[model samples]
Target chain A: MNPTACILVIGNEILSGRTQDVNVQYIARRLTELGITLAEVRVIPDQRAVIVGTVCDVRARFDHIFTTGGIGPTHDDITAPCIAEAFGVPWSVHPDSFRLLEAHFPPGEFNAARQRMATLPEGATPIANPVSVAPGFSIGNVHVMAGVPRIMQAMFEELAPTLRHGTPVTSRSWYALGLYEGALAEGLADIQDRHPSVDIGSYPFRRPDGRRGVALVSKGLDAAAVCHAADRVRELIERLGFTPAEGEPP
Target chain B: MNPTACILVIGNEILSGRTQDVNVQYIARRLTELGITLAEVRVIPDQRAVIVGTVCDVRARFDHIFTTGGIGPTHDDITAPCIAEAFGVPWSVHPDSFRLLEAHFPPGEFNAARQRMATLPEGATPIANPVSVAPGFSIGNVHVMAGVPRIMQAMFEELAPTLRHGTPVTSRSWYALGLYEGALAEGLADIQDRHPSVDIGSYPFRRPDGRRGVALVSKGLDAAAVCHAADRVRELIERLGFTPAEGEPP
Candidate 1:
């Protein structure tokens, strides 16, 4: 069975387009490399009710849950407490995180805004932030990280070595220039039927010279199956009277 | 009242991390510029059930709903029918869209795969696609468009004229180098309190020379108020013994 995960991106800045969410793609790519199936991703504003409802709903459905953004010191940053409420846990200043914050900004400098970063859910394990002192936390199966791409990436890299991984899927692709998708439909369907475990996708690409081509990609847990399916795709393209070009992996 | 909008990003490739979602940011930025508050963004796999559920939910919650991706001819592309099902509309070949598709891919070549591009929900009006012949459609307040950045931008440019826009919000950002967020805490709080209607945000940037700076951004519907607040930010930065840079409009 595939180990599935869901990501909840919490921030009003993201929804307002003030900030482009870079963490989702970073996390998704990392999860895919680890063989974890990222099933869904939801971006909700910093509103408490929405965040709480989405966290509860997604946590119930997916095997693992990851949330990015809203764990900062600002008033609009409400993800940590809301997520704690969703899990019915008490929220407090985590000792370890507080120590880390203290190390960065000593006593007099540690005001309300800086202190806010230390607050976390009860019984949560701190996810180390190599880039910044603001630590992320994990409660139950939910991993809450920072919104900033650099910080989120650092936290994920620190967390990755400990998580469970499934069999990594491999993919191969071939390109057919100036060939219509309709012309290869029947043969493509036949190849798909032959390889049940393999997933074949046809991506239409427009060349620099204005020629259209279909890049057929085959993906499967078994590398041999992926290779075999890709070979069938190449054969299908040739049968349709088009010479297949060696495709680059995307 | 704030005009609200929600974005539904539909694709299996996004969930699988094969594609990073860029359309959400494009839609969000454009909507925000029109003074439409983007309340939510949902990224779901190209599954009928999930798409329908999300579309129905978002449509109920927001003033306008915008969807991207999964309108292509591939088997995994399922956004149109799922949206139709959500609104209880019958799927049919739109005459105008059919003509457009036919014009792009002449007579005999207009096979099943190409034909799928013309399908739309009943009573839907076609949203012109400047980049591609396969046009997106709109039903009531929901605008459906392509996922490709260039295509999505083109579709939005076509649709923008028809959209009802609110008072556009203006923003200005003031920068201060080598100053920590902790140093500006008291002054930032004072500015925030003084301008409740305007949103003040502090974005920390690590310079190429390894210096840390905070870019304070002030936003509001009133341009004069935004400028006034930005001036206050510059004053605060100067008062703190830092060389304040002129606020750039954002």
Candidate 2:
């Protein structure tokens, strides 16, 4: 069985629609490449109880739980302490993280707020941030990272090599303009039935020129099964009198 | 207290990183405009147990639950059935929806696969889809809409008027180039303490040209409190020797 993962995005900004989250997609793609099945993604507020409750819930369910945001030096930056509380561990300054953050900042500038970033749950190891000095941390199965895309990407890159791997999920797709989902659903279902190992999904799209189409995607850990399903999807498109393009609809 | 909402996104395409979701943000912004608090957003796969379980879990917690995707005419379009199961209601074809969809499709073109789109839970009301003829539905407090942005937008517009509203959440923000969060976190916390009603968030950004900055945002249902907190944020930026610019960083 593949290792499963969940991204718990902790932020009021995302929930408020003030920030369009690009973090989940980036991490999802990376987890797919790493062969980890990203089972779920949750965007939640920075409220401490919610953070603590969700972290505890998801950590027990998934092999890896990655949390993003609320690790900064501000009043709402409550992820670290909340996480510590979740694990029933003491939240305090990690001597190494404190030293690193202190050295990174200039003289007399490392205030209490900045020092908050250096605190982590007892026994949690820091996930290095290549972009910024203050680090993210990992305790048990939960890996906490920054919300900013660049910083999160950097932290994930530093942390990826340590995760358990599975067979990377791969996909094959065929799309055609002028092909509607209603026209193709029966054939697609038949194809799906034949390829039980492959997951078949039909996505409908409308191009910029107002043309509608459907993209039939076949995905699985088995490359051959995925390809065979795609071939069947392509055949279905052609049999329905439409030319199949081997990608997402334009 | 404001009514709370949760958006449940159901699709394997999103988890597979094949699709970037714009539905949540659109719904979130609309809900915020309608004065509903969007407390959470969950993206889960197109699996029956997970869907039914999550739907039941969230529906009990929030005043409203908006679900996107898996309402199309394909094998994977199991959201209707799952939702029916979630509510412990009978999953069957609604006569009105059935006739509407049957008329929309050409004769004999409306196969079993297409007929699935017309099916709904026993007590559900269809939400009209202006972009496409097939309708989305609402049962209890859960509003199910299409995953496609255009169709989802249309469905939400139709459903919004019926939802209970509160004082619309509003925000005020001031950003300054070269202002670091570390330098401003202390005063921002002070401002946040003074305005207990407002939510103060400090977000750091790096311009493409490598200049770092911070945007201090004050959000609340109380317009005056939000603005007052933002004014303090602006003053803090000035006190730190950076000119504060209103709104998000360019």
List the TM values for chain B, per candidate: 0.94, 0.97
Candidate 2, clashing residue pairs? none
List model 1 lDDT by residue over A88-203, tens digit each: 99889888888889878766988887787899999899999988789998888899998878899999999999788988778787988887666776678778888988877776
Model 2, position B210: C-alpha lDDT score: 87
Q: What is the model-wide C-alpha lDDT for candidate 2?
A: 0.91
lDDT tens digits by residue: candidate 1, B93-176: 999899888888766888887787799999999998877789898998889998877888999888887887887778888888
How far out, in Å, is residue A126 in model 2?
A: 0.8
How many steric overlaps does candidate 2 have?
A: 0
User: Per-residue alpha-carbon lDDT of model 2 for A92-119, expressed as tens digits?
Assistant: 9999999999999999999999999999
Q: State in Å the error of residue B70, model 2.
A: 0.4
DockQ of 1: 0.53
